[model samples]
Target: MTRIGIVSRQQESDLARIPHVVRLVEDAGGTVVAESELRTADVVLVLGGDGTILRAAEGVRGTDIPVIGVNFGHVGFLAEADPESLADVVARLVVRDFTVETRMTLAVRVTQPDGSVETGWALNELALEKVERARMVDLTIGVDDHPISSYSCDALVVSTPTGSTAYAFSAGGPVVWPNVEAILIVPIAAHALFARPLVVGPDSTITVVMNEMGFVDGELWCDGRRRLAAPVGSHIEITHAEEPVHLARLWTSPFSGRLVAKFKLPVRSWRHQERP
Candidate 1:
């Protein structure tokens, strides 16, 4: 029997239904466990939204265990399966019917000009924005030691392919396929017309340096979890992480289809437009 770890957020929006899902897993002849009760588990079952899954990712970081998410909240991006399909998902897990998608993560390091450093990792994207005012942040961007451009902007986002649809997309970045091995740089409300989004190879290193003596200090946010106050003259270096997050998807679904269904995108139909 395989040991399965169950993880959830504090909100527990579906707290009443956890026991039912646990029973289903137990009936399948697998040992059900929680993060606190984890013990060499083969799989980690997450119950909640993307935030829950992210937390679970951090908890299982550096481990080889695969994580399966059952969506029980709104906008279940990472959590593909719904609560109603918990039994079906569990059954699939019982027989090892699943596909593991390795998602690229971002390893960010914040270094002061004096050489002090702070490090964090993000599955989605890292953001640098002003704290109080809506003023544009003056900064210089670099790629692999080469100077790219310096611009004033409300914020900047360094997103991975897995994070293309996140804040990066909303900020006018391209929707890169999850399997695409690339890094995305999106400027949020850039004041300069030439400041456009750029998609670069995953192997490249990206950096954003804050111009000291600016109007205000900026802030750096990682996966909306870890935070660091960006004092002036701080260097924010971002690169593809050596480790990837293993997501266990029970079913095979096309990315385009999921995007359309999730966003209710309008599709033009020739049949409906033409009268018979």
Candidate 2:
């Protein structure tokens, strides 16, 4: 029998739906397990929005545990299935009838000026944003030991292709498909002309140095969930993680289809005339 691990959004309404979801999985001859018992499970079912799925990803990092997400919140871009398809989702889980797709992740390391260091990972994008709004954070960015440019900016969004459509996109970065193996760098509200969205190879290491003379410090946000203080003269580095996030999918649609569906992009052309 297959074991299904469950992780929910934890909202009152989302929690209420778990009973029905568990019942469906049980009826399909699957056993439900806690997120902590993932070692014994074949797959994990996340019942929430993208944020919940990202949280689950963090737990299963460095493991090949495939996570299947059911959308229960607004703009569930990371969710592979909808809440209405709970029965199908359960059936697929019991039979192990799904494809596991790997998405690239970023391993982030922060070295404070005081010689302290911290390391973390992000499933989406890891952002470095201003801690104080009074002044912009001064940053000097580079790639693979080669200097690129330096300037003051509101934030610097370092993202994987899986994250390009997220904060990177909102920051005027290009929407790179998830399959593309690259690290995307986008400077947010940069005060310099040389700062622009950049795409580097997956093996590249991105480095950012916070200028010591800056008026305020910056904060390092991992998927907008985890945080670390980035003081002046701090050095931050990002690279493709060794372990990628695994996502189980029942749908065979291409990334363009997913993008169109998620953004609700109109495909109808001017040639399609409405009957008068």
Candidate 3:
């Protein structure tokens, strides 16, 4: 029997609904497990919003198991099915009828004073922002040992192609296809006139060196979940991770359609807006 692991956020109702889903999986000749008891599993099922999926991915990283997300909350970008459609989703899974997509992740390392270092990784973006007030922070950026830009801004976002449509897009970055082999650097509310987004090769190394500002420093947020207070003069290093997150996609929904559906975008073409 194949083993399936289920991970959920703090939502007690999602946890409550697991038994029904587990019964569905068990009826199809599979065993269900939880992350705590999951030493080895064939696949993982994530329940909650995008944040929950991100957290669950971290737990399953370095493993070959693919993740299928079930939407229990709003804005579930990673979920494959809604709560009401979980039975059909499990039926599809039982027949091994799904495609898995490998998504690149970013690994970040921060060099602190006295030669100390801190490290983390993010599936969406690694953002550096001003602390306390929204004062502009001075920063110098470099890519693969080459100087890129020097600017003062409220924040800076380093993102992967999978993250291009997330925070980076809101920061005026381009929406890159998920399979694109590139990285994005976007400046937030920058003072420099030339602070436009740049897409670099996947192997390139990106760094952000913060300059000293009055008594205020800045903060670093990973995937908008993990937070770290960064002192002035700290340097952040970002690079593509050696491992990628494998997501089980049961449908071929194009990224364009997802964007339109998620954002409720306006249709400009008369054909789309008008009856045939």
Candidate 4:
């Protein structure tokens, strides 16, 4: 029997659907398990939006377990199914009818002035933003040990292709396809003329050094979940993580279709095209 691990939001409305989802899993000849038992499960079923899915991914990081998201919140970008399709999704899982998509992740390390290093991982983007509202942060960027540029900005985001559509997109970075192995660096409200978003190869290492003369220190945020202090003179190194986030996909639709549907982009021209 398949053991399915479930992780849901704590909201009252989100909690209300757990029983129905559990019933579907049970009827499909699967056993339901808590998030703590995720490592032992065949797959994980996440109930919520993209944030919930991120949390689930963090829990199963470095493991072979795959995650399938069911949309129960606004902007379900990572979710593959909806509440109404829970029964069908469960049935499909039982029959092993799904594909797994491996998404690139980032491994971040912050080296403090005292020589101690802190590390974390992010499936989305790793952001270094100013903690003081009135002061901008000074940052020096580097790639593969070569100095790139120095600038003052509200924040800087180093994201994987999988994260390009998240914080990077909102910060004016290009939307990169998930299949692409690359990284995106976007500057938030930069004060320099050459401040622009950059896309680099996956094997490259990106570094950000916080200037010691800055008014205040910045903060490091990993996928908006893990937080750490980035003091002045601190160095942050970002590189592709060894393991990827495995997503269980039930649909064969191309990523282009998913992007158009998720953003509600007008594709009427394609639909109206003439065929010979």
lDDT of 1 by residue, 1-276 (tens): 877888876765566667877898889988787787553678888889888888888777777778888887677777879878888988888777888888989999999778889888889999898976857688999999899998888999999987888889889999988988999999988877689999988999998899985676788998888898787789988999998888998778898877887678898763635568
Arranged by TM-score with the best first, the candidates are 4, 2, 1, 3
lDDT of the candidates, in the order given: 0.84, 0.91, 0.84, 0.90
Using lDDT as the measure, the top candidate is: 2
Tens-digit lDDT string for candidate 2 (24-78): 9899999999877765678889998889999888778778889989998788898
Residue pairs that clash (backbone atoms under 3 angstroms), model 4: none
Give the runs in model 4 whose Cα sits over 4 Å from its true position: 271-276
**What local lDDT score does residue 213 receive in model 1, on the 0 to 100 scale?**
52
- Give the range where candidate 4 is weakest over 10 consecutive residues by summed lDDT: 265-274
Displacement of the residue 211 alpha carbon in candidate 2, Å? 0.7
Candidate 4 local lDDT, 90-129, one digit each (tens) = 8888777889999999999999888889999899999999
Candidate 3 local lDDT, 1-276, one digit each (tens): 778888887868777887888899899888888888544777888878788888778878887778888888787866778888888888777776789999999999888655678888888899998886746789989999888888888889999988887899889999888878899999989889789999999999998887765345888899998886677888888999998988998899898887777668897754655668
- Give the CA lDDT, 0 to 100, for residue 268 in model 3: 79
Query: Which 10 consecutive residues of model 2 have the lowest summed lDDT?
Result: 34-43
